[model samples]
Target: MRGEVEQLVGILFRTLAEEGYTEAQTALLDTYQSKADTDREELAEELFVEVVTNLSYHLETETEVEVLVTAIEQLLSWFSSLVEAAPVAILAVETDGQIEFWNDGAERVFGWSKSEVHQRPYQDVFAASSDEMEPHLAQLQDGKQLTGLETQHQHKDGSIRDVRIWAAPFRTRHERFEGATFVISDVTEQKQREQRLSVLNRVLRHNIRTDVNIIHGHLNQLAETVDDTTEHLRVMEDRLSNIIQLSDAARHIEQLRDEGEDGLTTIELESVIQERVTRLRKESANATIRTTLAESTAVVAHELLPYALDNILDNALEHNDAETPLVEIAVSTGETAASGQTTVSVADNGPGLPDHEQAVLTSEEETQLNHSSGLGLWLTRWIVRNSSGTLSVNKSTWGGTRIEIRLPTQTS
Candidate 1:
């Protein structure tokens, strides 16, 4: 029993050292190191008796040696509760995708029992997770950690759950690569709220006010003007339809924002451009338009890209003052050869964009004084920015203005 008590005291000393109880560890070591001639057995016995004596005045536990051993075991067991109490799914896996540890939080998040998924592969929790999983493993394989990786995960009932995962390569104390630690948090409701708020803000700010003003202004114009209001009414009709189209485009942008990068598609630039150009020619019969599109020009854009293109073309014609109002459209690759980008250049034989309009598009830091009058160029710039692209303004060789938009080949 004395030997057993000594062994337990040795363990307690080691535990205190490991737990960063520096003062207690120093006191315990000083007992023996200060007197090297003292027998270890006597020294451990002396320390054990001192702890039982001191703890008797503090904690409610018994002073018996056997009670002390039981207390230490309980302390070690209690440490495991931290993992169970965590709010997010906490899981540990092996390099071969074996599930090593799954806490209670993991069970609640994934809806899987410990007995059913103890040694199962980690991929069972994911649903069509290839897009992010490939990059995740590549980073882990190179000993890097990834955070805020939003991906799709499959629940036990086969329903898709939206979650943001934080992962890192797990290793043993000897630096051997094991698997990884995955912390998952569900963000579906949060994302939905964000999307709803964005749509409401847009409706309140731009869409509703513009539609009401256009209707009211047209009504007043016809009431006051007794002369030929046919041409004026005709322009009002186009403006009314444009309001609907742009409002829908703004809603689509909100949808894409909610879906993140997974919602985008590879769009054929030539096809989208040719369709818009055909419509433009029919809309303005007197305006001369030309297009130069290559056979296979492509860009990664969302579905609302045509709305942006049409607005740019409309701006060129509406602002033209030349006798021959000519618009030139060309599509090709940009000079940044490493980045796969499809550049769309639209030039017109007009008075060109004002300096303020040009500054808003090309400036790094814009002030209140550098604002534009209309939303035409702002809408075009917004579309390009949201699609992981860039917009530039330059003088066209056709003696007017040119707006060069460069779109990249990847989604955010």
Candidate 2:
């Protein structure tokens, strides 16, 4: 029994030594070596009391350090909670491209649960091919931080999501770079809005420059000729009105931006069309306006749908060379409520829209030679696009042009 106690005490001291209790290890070693023949029970108790005393002394002396460690742990826990609850995705990845952390926001934004992606390769979260990820990985490995990197990622549903990422490399206490933390925000809507503004800004500047040059030439011509000035004056006045209308169209774009998502509201399609038809009838008495609107056709569209309709209706009449321009406005819906679409069509019995004029809506891009005569059609297309709708220009049954604006039904 005495030999067993000695062995156990020796084992305990060895464990303390392995755990870096150097003072206790040294004391135990000195006593063990110098007092091998001493009474085993007395030796055991003496060493036990010495260890207990040292433990108590250390505990008392390091109370503040322990408290500080506890506080730091609590602060880290709070920071982790904040990152998890953030509205944007937060990801932590190792230098080896392994994902270490995926917060709740990451799961929400990317549609991948932490359990699904934890410890997976960072490449798994992005849609980019390995070749495409190489450059970004190289940059990270070089300890470079990336900011506002506008890119597209794939959601778990296989749909694309536009995002802007901010990432920074993190290091260990010894300043060795180990991994990167990524902060990603969904910027899909914002990018779309910026694209819209860019397109409109470019087109407006081009058209305004052309109109100004034409006006300058007209002013020079008027200065050279005083006879039959009536026609020249009419042309100048028309161009001036067009310039004003273009400026107003820019204001409409601003209004759309200002209103943003709030601009979309449920509207009764038939009533809105009837109201515009009535107003246009008063404005263009010589033109015949007809409507075949379905009763209570409701859709979720931009509040500026009426303005879009006005542009189409007015274009149908204005571009018509017919002595009695006949304009037809019709509203149609899918066969079933679940089909989830409503189409408003404007047809005209006149010369069909020229390809250049239609290019503003149909073509992916507008060149200097392939641009529209005005911004009306462009504005209409912009409104339809921002409303999450589609606009189609096709041939009408009456040997003219038919413009259709398709919107999501309220039931959708």
Candidate 3:
């Protein structure tokens, strides 16, 4: 009797499709046919009635038997198309862990075609051994569903791929656990960006707290020692100013991360250098500023290139102990037009940069032993890197620190 009701439901849908049903009725028919197998007879009848009433179509549940066989052909075709073309990786595994289905998205994400992975062990996709997958497979066999399970998998080239997975166990008509299906999303780039931001936030917070404590201690000392308080007051003022500048640097870092390369534009290196040098000369009237800017040395860089140049220029004069600080700014083009790199060198006749501070910019990472003297250098590095440029520290010919920035020129 239950079989007969299911058969009757299929017949009704086939009849509806043939009768020139409204688009809404056809859509409902498609949904009904896909779910009719597991739907209870009462619920199926309710849905059928709703659709018929909406479309004003009379039910003909005893249609030709042949039409019932192919009633869901369109729905199955649509479902297959959607699965194959989905943006996320989707695959099916057998109870024994063999991959039974591999869709287009899986191929694209994993860099392996269906034919290459078909009938392969499910563990082949993961970076770890079968041991790593045993727990997940065991859960699937227990008829459990896994949602948003984040883990790393193996790419075809042996690179690690961070992914988030959703898995569900599929059962047979007899309610036996057969296997599981998995949907995976590639999140490597997203994960890296998040880690970068997290580390920067942590470091910035730590620096701010530590500096504030130092300033507080200095204030207490100043209150006690009224003798020769002039130098002490000057030191406190310097600390306060550094704290404010750090806040500004934090804001700049946030903007760089949020906006990314959207602000990049082709800029003439000569004009940018001239403008910054002119302003710096006015600000530091006692200092001698000289420039040898290369003409038509255009490069693709951020609009904030001037800000980075200012950091370099300011650091030069600020750290100098000379009676009259001298800064030399020079720009030179690459040797060849094709594949040439434009170079900007800023040299200061100040005491050379400390080895530890230089390591902050040169090293692959920052640590307690090697941290930036200030956020200004780090900010400069960030701007240059995002512009597809490189920054380096070397001793100048004048026996002082020379900071060089190399940037790729715009392609014609």
Candidate 4:
């Protein structure tokens, strides 16, 4: 006697044949046909349960076989086209880390056909660094799904590739553990472009900035001579320095974006702030620069903290038209019931921050109109954000702007 499941499938298959769904149905079955006998049976069992569960309404109502099969065929066709149309590599992996199914996209990507790689160990064929594979394998072993995982893969030609993967664990109809499905996207070109940009930015900010700064220093000394070209040299020097500052801010912004919040670490904030303040005091010798830092105060932040702070302090000093620009830095640290916090406040007796720039600093979104004038405030904002900190600009006691960076402590 035929079982109910088998009988249902038989009736559905005949109706599919009559409705011209045989080709799509055959292609769907062919995927399971490629697996080993045991794996094929398991996959079919899962698929059977899925089909039965989905069409339970039709079965209960004794709906016309033709209607049911047409619905099934449409679903099958959609699945087939979806699998075939995917642009990235797709693989079905078993629990023990063996390859079960490799789509055409996978074959084109990894340079191996399904016939060649079927039933093969996944690690042996698709190579990745142990460091990179460790987390993924652990996740799979725990029957967990992962998405948008960025890692590297070794190619048939012994070349390395940067790839992103979205993977999920599968299960059988009886709730038995099966394997994982993976979609991989190659990102070698994307990674290479970022590298090239990093190199170019470093050259512009470091080497080029260095050469221009030298000229700026010489121009300043020449401006004191009262020569005919002294004023022109001074103007050129000032404008050139502005450009250099923009480059510096841009470099800081790039680092913040590339490294992200996870790159923050613990460091003594007092020393970094003091070192930068001392340098700024010497640079603007006429300006009165004061600092109030707690002893041995530390904060969790990116290594670019000194550079970012310099930009803030530089703006406070440079934008001042006062005869004696007064800029003060106050550093403090404290603890709450949950976490500790550190704050660095830079208050200046200069023209307050521009409304547009303040809007950029406070904005959570980036649009052309609400963007920073250059990169100074934006860089500071990103640096603070990436450090798991907050930035606020408001009126200072000296009738100027006070920029504050508040950083949360890293939990042990």
Best by lDDT: 3
Question: Per-residue alpha-carbon lDDT of model 2 for 1-412, expressed as tens digits?
Answer: 3454444455556555555667656766776677778777887867655655554554454742443345445556757888978999999998788899888998989899988888888876775554556677678778788877767887888878898889988877687879999999988788788878868776786788687778878776885677656786778767777776787787787778777667999999888888888888998899998889888889898898788888888889888998898999899999998889899989999899988888887766669966888777887888888789998889999899998889999873
lDDT of every predicted structure (CA atoms): 0.74, 0.79, 0.80, 0.76
For residues 278-396, could you state the per-residue lDDT of candidate 1 as single tens digits?
A: 88899888999999987777788755567678878888998899887899999887655576888888999999888998987777545788787655556566667767778888888
Candidate 4: pairs in clash:
none
TM-score of 2: 0.50
Candidates ranked by lDDT, best first? 3, 2, 4, 1
TM-score for every candidate vs. truth? 0.51, 0.50, 0.50, 0.61
Residue 37 CA error for candidate 3 (Å)? 66
Q: Model 4, 288: alpha-carbon shift in Å?
A: 5.8
- Cα RMSD, model 3: 20.7
Model 3 weakest 10-residue run by lDDT: 59-68
Best by TM-score: 4
**Candidate 4 wrong stretches, greater than 4 Å:** 1-92, 100-120, 128-139, 142-149, 154-160, 166-178, 181-183, 202-229, 246-263, 279-295, 322-328, 332-335, 364-373, 397-399
* Consecutive 10-residue window with the lowest summed lDDT within model 1: 57-66
- Per-residue lDDT over 1-412 for candidate 4, one digit per residue giving the tens place of the 0 to 100 score: 2243444454555564565655545643553365436554465565465444444533443544545766567657766788877878988988887899788888777788889889987777777654556568768767787888887898777788889988987876676678888899989899999989988888778887887878877876777776856567757866897887778667767767687766688878788887887888889999998889887777888877776797788889989988899999998777562658888999999979888888878998768778666776777777777778898999999889998889876555
Query: In every candidate, how many clashes are there?
Result: 0, 0, 0, 0
Assess the local accuracy of residue 4 in candidate 3 as a C-alpha lDDT between 0 and 100. Answer: 40
lDDT of 4: 0.76
Regions of model 3 farther than 4 Å from truth: 1-233
- Tens-digit lDDT string for candidate 3 (263-368): 7899888888888888888889999998888777899888778789989898899889888899999998877888668889999989999988788667767788
